[model samples]
Target: MQLLFAAPARKPLQVDRHLRRQIVRYLTTCFEILSPAAEELIPDELEQWGQLRIGNGGDEIHARGYHKLRPDGRDAAFVRYELMVDQEADNPSVDERLEPESQYGELQHIFVLTIPPKTPKVNPHRKKKRHLLLAQIYEAPFKFDEADKYKVIWYKGKLGTGEVVDALTIQCVIDAGEYLYPYIPMFDSIL
Candidate 1:
């Protein structure tokens, strides 16, 4: 006897509430460390910063990048949260030049929250899930060898846990850098 059966229907992707809350906490801590005063002054901007959304499959987190000054009050950085597939080239390229190399006195930081790709549910009884890989925080500095005017200087896997502690530590480091060497004009500042 032959048996006939229909394939199981695919379920819609649901937002991970736990991960969402973690992201919110992470961003909150970052902003508080980076610019506590600005939060109250620019509530709208901070609200926008906390907004997170799901992106189309294939490694892209649909979220707006937030810009704020470092604790030193001179330097600035752009913080972004993204859900990305494990595949290479999915993350935004830092190769493009945001501004001229000669116009900057300091490098601008690009802090990113990277969510690794979801594992495929190979078994019928199993379910796919996503998790935070690491927070990639890098500096966009000037370089002459490449086509683009800027080069990326990674912070050696800083904020790898995507937790408040890491965020605060990174903030302090950034502030210290600024204090020791004041008046470092970033590319964003020039633009």
Candidate 2:
């Protein structure tokens, strides 16, 4: 006899315009300051990968960049950048939106930074875990709890290949009134 099992339901991944720009700006600025040399390499690298475009924004800035193979052996390659904006009306109540789950109106433009695992060299004691890029903000009028920081929310999205992925260390959220404007602390670092 054949047995039947229940399949779990999946949550939807929302893409916002303002959030996309914020992510691109944040990552671009970060890379510019972190590695100016790398910034100059973006154009060339991007060409070899594929075309990029904003997927869900009115300003043709929703999506940016394409995936490419890094020098390492990982599932995916390269970073996909975009900003996510939780509009004023979307913000959930302090009680509900505290955690990444129920929180609404949390605009989060995510830079899907993907780095594949690299092969070891002479030492042979190096093995890196696959990393996916993700960052976001949870903005609410009233402060719910101290545990959940406004910045950094657990986000999940699907890749171009339709493979499900999860991104950690996703810390980057906009303030209540600051729509589309990211708090670029490292802005001055850009030359």
Candidate 3:
């Protein structure tokens, strides 16, 4: 029952993404992906998390983390979406300097959609499925310590029940943190 857009329109922006094992390698266990909206329901808990303390630098606070931000915070360096799963995964095993703190838990992996440099006509084939694209990546020693659950929001598109076909949510939670490594166009053309 996830809404795709906030307004109705004849032409809607669509997205899709498929990652191979390489993408998984970049993200280790511990962290899980979650939808921006679903994360909202648990706000009170998040606020309390801020009181938690972390790091050798005494008195520093730790709070619940969030994937997305509000319009004002839209300028945020990266946009995040949920990657839900049934069970806990292992902690990310990438280079330590490249990872967020274990307290954040390894909850990496977000999907985004981009228009590229040019807006080509939407292909009929590409429209068949709900898609997500990887627009950017984030590294560790992150800007924030814990996720401010209240900060992020979910996708609020207007699909109505009929126009919409399918919706699914996977919730992954890790004790470590997640990682995101953008997919590079390994080749100039898929020749």
Which candidate leads in TM-score?
Answer: 2
- Candidate 2, residues 1-191, lDDT tens digits: the string is 11111221132233344443444454454334333432322221111112122223211111112323323422121222223334443656633322233322232232334333441221123466433334343332222333644333222222221111122321221222212433211110001
The TM-score values for the models, in the order shown, are 0.21, 0.22, 0.18
Comparing 1 with 3 on TM-score, the higher-scoring candidate is 1
Q: What is the per-residue lDDT of model 1 for residues 1-191, given as tens digits with 9 covering 90 to 100?
A: 11111221132222244334444555454334333322222211111121121222211111112334434454323332222223433456544333212211111211223322331221122343322222223332322223456532222212232222222122112211232332332222111
- lDDT tens per residue, model 3, 12-103: 22221222222222222322323332222112211111121112332211112223333343222221223333332344553333422111
Number of clashes found in candidate 2 = 22
Give the lDDT ranking, best first: 2, 1, 3
Question: Distance from true position, residue 152, model 2, in Å?
Answer: 21
Clashes of each: 2, 22, 39
Model 3 TM-score, all chains together = 0.18
Measured with C-alpha atoms, the lDDT of residue 191 in candidate 2 is 15
Candidate 2 residue 49 Cα shift, in angstroms, is 25
After superposition of all CA atoms, the RMSD between model 3 and the true structure is 20.0
TM-score result, candidate 1: 0.21
In candidate 3, how many Å is residue 132 off? 5.3
Name the runs in model 3 displaced over 4 angstroms. 1-75, 85-87, 90-132, 141-191
- Which regions of candidate 1 deviate over 4 angstroms? 1-64, 70-125, 133-136, 140-172, 176-191
